[model samples]
Target: MSDHPMALIYGGTPHRFPMLLVDSVEELSEGLGRALKQVSANEVLLERFGDAPPTLPSCLLVDALGQVAILLLRERDGGAASVWYLGGIEAMTFHTAIPAGSVLRMEARVLKRWRTTARIEVKAWIGAVPVADGFMVLSQRGSGSNE
Candidate 1:
C-alpha cells in the first residue's frame, strides 16, 4: 500500500494499476476536485502506435476525468464502500491530441447529486491548452448490493 493520501482514497475504488489513470489528487472540496495524470511513453495504450509519436487516446482521456470524479465521490461519501459506475457521458469535446510527455490536469465538479446518482462536469488540459470537456453521470451501488 502506498502512503500517499490520494492512494489511500483510491483504495476505496475498484480501479488498479494500468487502469488507474489519475496519478495524484491536487485538491478536493465539496463538489469539486482536481487531479493529475502523467502521460508516459511506456503507457500500455501507446504500445499500439509503435513508432508514431505517442498520443493518449480520447477514450483514455475521458476515463482519466471519470477517475477524478470518482475521487470526489469517494471523498464526499467519506470512503464508504460502494460500487460506482459510469452511467453516461454528455457533450464531450476533444480539443487536441495529448502527447505522452505532457501532464494531464483534470478537474471535476459535481453539478448535481440525487439518491445514488450524480452528474459531474469534467475537464482536462495539457498546460493551458484544453484537451477535453464533458459531463458524466455516475451511479453508485451501495455496499448492501448482493452482487
Candidate 2:
C-alpha cells in the first residue's frame, strides 16, 4: 500500500462533476457508508426516459450506487489510474421514478474482497420507499478491456 493511509474524502473532485449522485458522505466505516445524492432537473432529462415521462434511469441509479462503492473501495485501497466497470449487475429493482429535483439517499456495503475483485451491495431510496437496489463488481482499469 506504499505511503497510503486509511482515509476517505466525501464526494471530491471528479466525483462531483457530471454523474455525481451521492452528495454528502454522511458516514463511512469499514468500507460501508450512507451517502446522499441530490438530483437536479438537469439530471432528470426527458430524453433519458425515451417515450416515458421525465424520470431517472434505473441504470443511472445503479451508477450512482456503484460510484459510492468505488469511492469507498479506493479510500480503503488507493486511487488507481485504471477504471472499473460493472462486471455484473443483478437483482436490481426500481420502485419509483426518482423525481428530477430531489435528494436521494444511498447506501453501499462491501460484501467481499479478493486479490483483484470486490463485491459490494448497493441500495437507494427516496425517503422510506426503495428506489433501487443492486450489487456491483469492480476491477482494476488497465488490466481489463476498459482501457
Clashing pairs in 1: none
lDDT of 1 by residue, 1-147 (tens): 466865665675678887888888888789999988899988888535667788998998888898888888977887777777899999999999998799999999999998889999999989999999989999998776312
Specify the highest-lDDT model's number: 1
- Expressed as tens digits, the lDDT of each residue in 21-68 for candidate 2 is 566677667879777877777663324544665577767787788877
Q: For each candidate, what TM-score against the reference?
A: 0.90, 0.74
Error of 1 at 143 (Å): 1.3
The whole-model C-alpha lDDT of candidate 1 against the native structure comes to: 0.85
Pairs that collide, model 2: 21-37, 23-36, 83-141
Q: Cα-based RMSD of the predictions, in order? A: 2.6, 5.3
Candidate 2, which segments miss by more than 4 Å at Cα?
A: 1-16, 44-53, 78-82, 142-147
Highest TM-score scorer: 1
Which stretches of candidate 1 lie above 4 Å from their native place?
1-3, 47-51, 144-147
